[model samples]
Target chain A: DTAVSQTPKYLVTQMGNDKSIKCEQNLGHDTMYWYKQDSKKFLKIMFSYNNKELIINETVPNRFSPKSPDKAHLNLHINSLELGDSAVYFCAIGWGNTIYFGEGSWLTVV
Target chain B: GESVGLHLPTLSVQEGDNSIINCAYSNSASDYFIWYKQESGKGPQFIIDIRSNMDKRQGQRVTVLLNKTVKHLSLQIAATQPGDSAVYFCAALRAGNNRKLIWGLGTSLAVNP
Candidate 1:
């Protein structure tokens, strides 16, 4: 019974291929976010959705798209993956700025 | 210009010892602070949090101290055990319509038995 869970815990794909990472939260949170952690362990926010509405979209590339079909789910799709896109992606759910994170999905673009 | 950083990259402590990890933030608008523990090959886990109005908050065996004047935040763990070994991160959360959460570089803590 995890509060937050993500699919494709580890994925290896060729460059230019497309892939998606899915996330869901059972904590009844109104806000969900996607954060990318680089090799340096620097966590950068990519997108934030509140009640399935796009709230905060960072300066990420257009190839990276986030979709929230409902408040419980948020999925990220990356097109034309690059070597620089190889990093751990985290899904977080929260309300009022306090967050709970998923186990993380490691994406490796070769 | 907005960033959160840790003072040390790594920290080592013996079992039963107290551990202190420090962080500094440049954004004065941030009104909330949080500490997270990320174990190897796992996502970060929330540890503790404090508000700008409070100077200190404690949870279980962990304590978070916030110094708004100096923009410093510290997490203190009592009776550090090997299980407590992980990378600790401090994040600053700005309150308002624009929700920007700034994360620190993280401090790796190794507790020896």
Candidate 2:
């Protein structure tokens, strides 16, 4: 069974388009995180939700919003995406002082 | 803000040789440290983690050494194989009430056959 999974392994869209990426974790971890990995492989935290409550909101622009319907799901919605937004988005879970990541959603904005 | 960084961006080693990847963290209040391995087109996988109370921890073939005084951490892989080739990252968690884990830039390890 997949512990953490993210949909749309690959996404390509034109500029100004809006899209959403879905994530789910079967580990039953209360805390879920969304991370962005740039082309240079630098990982940055975008948002985090604990028990469907917003906990950490980084300096990410308002164009990106994270919604957690429940403890098992966290989805990322991007509005009016730009070229610079193209990168790998990973959904992770933090539990018991450890963290696990999803396969990653590769987004490319043309 | 606290930051985790690596000494070398890339390291090349031969098969069967032991490999060491070093990381430096700026936060003195960090109480937990973790090492991750990320292969191409995959997410970062947990390898090992060490608490500030302990100096070292070992897994099957991996060992993580943490030096609190120097605020440095290193991961040692024994008899590295081709399958071990991947990017290694180090993350530090602050001691306070927060869930943010500062991650390092990453060190690419290439195991030559």
Candidate 3:
């Protein structure tokens, strides 16, 4: 079974459009994270939730918001997406020292 | 700002040959380090990891070497195969309340037969 899963493997929308990507992990981990991978293949942490509590929030703009209903689920909502919002978003669950990531959701804003 | 960066952006190796990817981190406080491999259309996969206390760690066919003095890390793959072609990234984690990892600009590895 897939330990971590995210919905909408691919998302394509026009500028100014809003969308949400949902993620879930069955690993029963206490901490979950949202990462953005740019075209240069640089992975950057956007947000992290430890047991549904916001722990890490990077310099990301307010247009992007992350919500974790529970420890098992974390979702990202982007408002008024822009061209720079296009990238691959990955959901990950961390326990101890290791982390497991989902397949990733590709977001493209035209 | 502290960040993890790679020395070479890309590396080409022949099948059955050894490959090495290097990374440099600016944060000396980072105690934990990990190497990840990412294939096309997929998330980064954990390859190997090392701590500041250890200088080298070996896995199935991969090895991770850490140099705390210079804050450098390297991942070496033996007998690289075509399936091993992917992007390799090095990440560092400091000992603190923040568990967020600082990632490096990945190095693209191409294994040619």
Top DockQ prediction, candidate number: 3
Q: How much TM-score does chain B earn in each model?
A: 0.95, 0.95, 0.95
How big is the positional error of residue A53 in model 3, measured in Å on the Cα after superposition? 0.6
Kindly list the per-residue Cα lDDT of model 2 for residues A11-91, writing each as its tens digit. Answer: 999999999999999988889999999999999999989899998999999999999989999999999999999999999
TM-score of chain B of 1: 0.95
Model 2 steric clash pairs:
none
Off by over 4 Å in 2: B95-97
TM-score of each: 0.96, 0.98, 0.97
Candidate 2 reference-contact recovery: 0.62
TM-score attained by model 1 = 0.96
lDDT of 3: 0.91
Badly placed stretches (over 4 Å) of model 1 are: B96-98
Ranking by DockQ: 3, 2, 1
DockQ of each: 0.70, 0.70, 0.72
Clashing pairs in 1: none
List runs of model 3 lying over 4 Å from the truth: B95-97
